[model samples]
Target: MIPGRDFPGKTALVLLTSLAVVISPALAFAHTGESGLVLLLPTDYYLLGGTLAVLASFCLIFLWPAARLERLCAASLPIGSLRVPSQTAISAIACLFLTALILSGLFGSRDPRSNPLPVTIWSVWWGSFVFVQAACGDLWYYLNPSIAPSRLVRSLLRRPAALLRYPGWLGHWPAILSFGFFSWLELVDLAPDDPTRLARFVLLYLGVTIAGMVLFGEDIWLARGDPFSFFLRLLAHLSPIDPRPMPADPARRRLFLVLPGSRLFHLPALTLSGTLFVLMTLSSVSFDGLSRTFRWLSLAGINPLEFPGRSAVLAFNTTGLFGVWLVVAAAYLGVIALGQLINPTWRLVRAAGLLVISIVPIALAYHFAHYLTILLMELQYVVQIYGDPLDRGWNPLGLQPNFVTASFLNDYHAVSIIWNLQAGAVVLGHLVAVAVAHVLNARLGGTGWRAVVAQVPLAILMVLYTLFGLWLLAAPNIG
Candidate 1:
């Protein structure tokens, strides 16, 4: 229980593993016809049922005693020491693997669907990896291909501490900027799916990450500058397993099993930059879903029937991306302002930090709702490509490549199941957010009517988000 210690545990989850959807815009446009997974849109009955479920969960929170809720948030169990492999060995393997993958991207098949790099990056890593890592824990701590090699090289050479101290004022500004640029590359860049171009982007990013690590300390840079690492670290808070660094000795860390959302409660209050970064995550995920809808395209003056190439609508989409972000930020701030108005004692900065955490679940929900089809369908390609990463048509693992066809989705039962799953994730995500807000209310607003009143604005926003998320899934879209 050291103040400002190396690791402090917070227990809470907002499920905004929304990073899964943001990384694969190219795949959003890759499929067509009944030959692919066809999700039947949910009807009005589904939306009504889903919203009522969320509302019921919110009302149920009021019956729980504050102490009882607090106990749930405080729950944790040390799981003993986690034995890990040598960093150098992991790094060497990852480096070799990535190098080969990059070469394949540069020289392999031109078709994006057939190429390993695009599929690996968009489907495997962003789609499946994000979901798995967020649920399980911070796998990136050991397995991130970028960081492992950087750390090994630095350690082998006995790299000195940073020549320049990282400025506190910068906060997570670097990560915020990195995220923005990366989102643009995914959503607006003309040829993100082109294997050669995709490989080039990876190389450029690798160089930038290495240079940043060289300039700042590895730990500091990764925490504040690397977008993927930063994104994954936030998602880690929602995981049931947490890696807590030993306070007295920074070199040592231990694993613990905690309630799924429990780890977030102990994180130091986010800074202004950090708060905005969290908002950006929510905004980015929302925009990713929103932009794909026919309504979004119409706003950009593009006909859904006569859809041009991504290049034609680049400027329009780019504007829409920034527009969504700004609108969401403004709306969020406005809601915060209203909350402060409701409770004169609550400070804006503290309220922003506490309330923004509630949005994580909504982001996570939309991610599953929108991209579940992609993950389920495209994951087959990931398995098939694994044995023949170079596309040599060799099945080294002797595994049958079970490909998902339009026929699989065309089954009425199959479509019904997928549609229900999408709706369930959206509803469950919002319920989780409601529960998170309930805990925050008890902790920050104290007891009685005052406590309930403080959460009113945020609660309303969560409801709206839940409705919006479900609509995005069930709404008719051009893609």
Candidate 2:
């Protein structure tokens, strides 16, 4: 779709490089009866077929209706001033609650003989990677679970006045300070295994988040100008919808409210984000559940816990996590939707669509890079263990007994080959996305191709460094 770009050539090069690194090794090692890991599974074939079928059905059901709805909205809504509410207090409370829950889970003793110090701290440290983004994008405001209900209650209390009143300033520096402090703790590994240290860290984060929201004002921080806001603005370009212009007039605006729809279906941003949140939670739960199931299944005729009960509990917890993630995602969408409501003429749908599309490449690259790095780094350890034939001692760090039963050297080689292939795919995916973005920009009169070209090297280097850091973590080492 991008003009002047040779997709075939780029794709061919990717394939060739992948083969040289992944497939060639397999062929050479074939004589030794060793096979390299293959990324694609037979199950993938069935999954792909099912996906196509579902997509076709969806198109048949909704494509025309969705188009008509879009046209109607485009014609009806008028442009007007935008007014997004402040969410400082709500966001602060959310940060506190979430931090408390995670800390409790991490530090609280689960078994009588088990110590809660090091493991809990390590868990929190790992969690830091996932929660850091909240500090980056005024994400606390969006992720806070209390916001919606609080706003509704406030509205009920105030009646007419609530309609126009925006959330007041709580503070901003507190959040920044909190983020910096936590980042320091994680980076320095200060008191790395101490529960007290982790508790202190959590307290500091909560204190800062709360203090900042109280001092600076959430609405002002969320508006354009701040670095986080700026990045979000740039990311917004990927969205198919626009949130800048207000709707044309009151009558047109009323139509959106009058339309009868499922709550999930009505909120496009919420639906998209919520779906992803659910999928991630489900995948994690399913992976763990299936693993437990297999372990039990292997025991000859010994039925452990009821499989149905175990599955039900897993499902419940998975659903709960999904709900929590959905709440956070919905809060984010709510903020943007408010912006759209303020300016009705804004094409929110198209902007949302584009943003969703743009994120795909980045998400894929992140996942592939993470898993590949893990596989590669682990392979090195496996090789060391297997290459030493005289060593019969258990390798706690090696994957032989833990991952799969095979010659340590052969298993490591297979994993390494797969990792290399995945890494190549990750790199290729990102480069292609950048190029595609540039091409799309040109077509849309956005940034020039030269700008994208200038940044490619830097982007690649950054990706490499990130992957390397992750690889270091993936290797077996005591926290």
Candidate 3:
């Protein structure tokens, strides 16, 4: 253990008690997934420090003047340039890859882990690639499968414009709905990881995206209608690598190493729909964590140990998914309203649009914390599949079925390391969120003290959320 300082007696005791209350039905945490070792831990002790760290970060921000912070965020070093290949070529390759995965799903092994499609979608795409996007910048721009097909059709017809103009009033509601349905497919659906079912769903998604692109322009549809591309674009804003098209050659982009989240400094207030989109992103991830908890299963009248499969609670979990999102949406809007009460000049909705970007780091943190174990376990299967593209058991790599090992998860010491790593990520993410929120408030133009005062409510909410995030880590999980 990396020992530092322990929380004082009463404070530590109280936090432990709070953790108990939040995670009732004790020992529920130790039987499932990679979190089994968490039951005997001093998890609440970790939570106390995480909560304090978030509060300290919030307080520390008041010391730095807005200009100094802006300068800090804007600091960067040039990293030369790279010329991108034609989008049509890049997208065609991506499209071919997608087609191969779909074929593999249709004809390969029935096992979800062995199947290339499910492993790639659940483990590779959502698990690892997302973090890559947050580290590097918008690489997905060159890899969208829908773009190549749409562009090829447009060129063949000798018309750059689409069949119809995208409506201005529509906003990002289409993207919001796309994401909402996808969350359901990922979380509540009984056989989301089933190869054949997932392949069909992907086909449906491709058809819709292509039709929308052909009718209403690739750029607009991708930016406003497709869920994966738009969400990745949002994540790209937090990357340190800043890529901008070269003035002399549009094909090449100049890259600079700026501070992470620095791009957010220049982003204008989002539309009302855009704000909801951000909120929904956070809410759906939260629900994903919540739905898997022992507490949630108990509430739905399912025994944690006996654990009826997903088929039994499909309807109940489906409603719970939407219920969690609606509750989060309501609470977020209300918090913004409370903040607006302190500063009457700003309208309720616009104020939310301005500050919502600050939540991006928190959302990304949740993504990492919630899915890290899955990535660790499933990535082994991915490497195995490299040798057996169709899972035909060719034995070229001489890999045994034991290649997908869960031994580390069963060991207490290894599990502790994993848990601590997850805790650290959750804490650091909140600290960055506090800083981002402070910088954004400073952009509103006020004296130092006034700027600090304006963000007090937000800071408090962040602290509470920090506690919640920690609790989610130590909470009893269902699977």
Best by TM-score: 3
Candidate 3: give the clashing pairs.
Answer: none
For candidate 2, write residues 73-149 as lDDT tens digits: 23212223334445656554655655554464355543211323233333322333222332222243455433444
Better of 1 and 2 by TM-score: 1
Error of 3 at 252 (Å): 2.2
- Least accurate 10 contiguous residues by lDDT in model 3: 24-33
- Give the alpha carbon lDDT tens digit for every residue of 1-479 in model 3: 00122334564354345433433322222112345344455876566655555555665665566555665566676778888778779889999999999988888777886788998888889889999999988889888888888887888888789899999999988999988888899988988889999998888899899988988998889888898888899899989888877789988988887767878777777778888888888878877777777888888889888887988889988898888778867777787777766666546677777788888888887788778777877767888877678666666777666454555666667767666566555555655566677677765555534455767777777667666655665787866
Off by over 4 Å in 2: 1-180, 219-414, 417-425, 436-479
Q: Pick the candidate with the highest lDDT.
A: 3
List TM-scores for all candidates, in order: 0.84, 0.34, 0.88
TM-score of 2: 0.34
How far is 256's C-alpha from truth in model 3 (Å)? 1.3
TM-score between model 1 and native: 0.84
How many clashing residue pairs appear in each of the predictions shown?
17, 41, 0
Candidate 3 ranges with C-alpha deviation above 4 Å: 1-33, 39-46, 404-413, 445-450
Ranking, TM-score, top scorer first? 3, 1, 2
Model 3 Cα shift for residue 372 (angstroms): 0.9
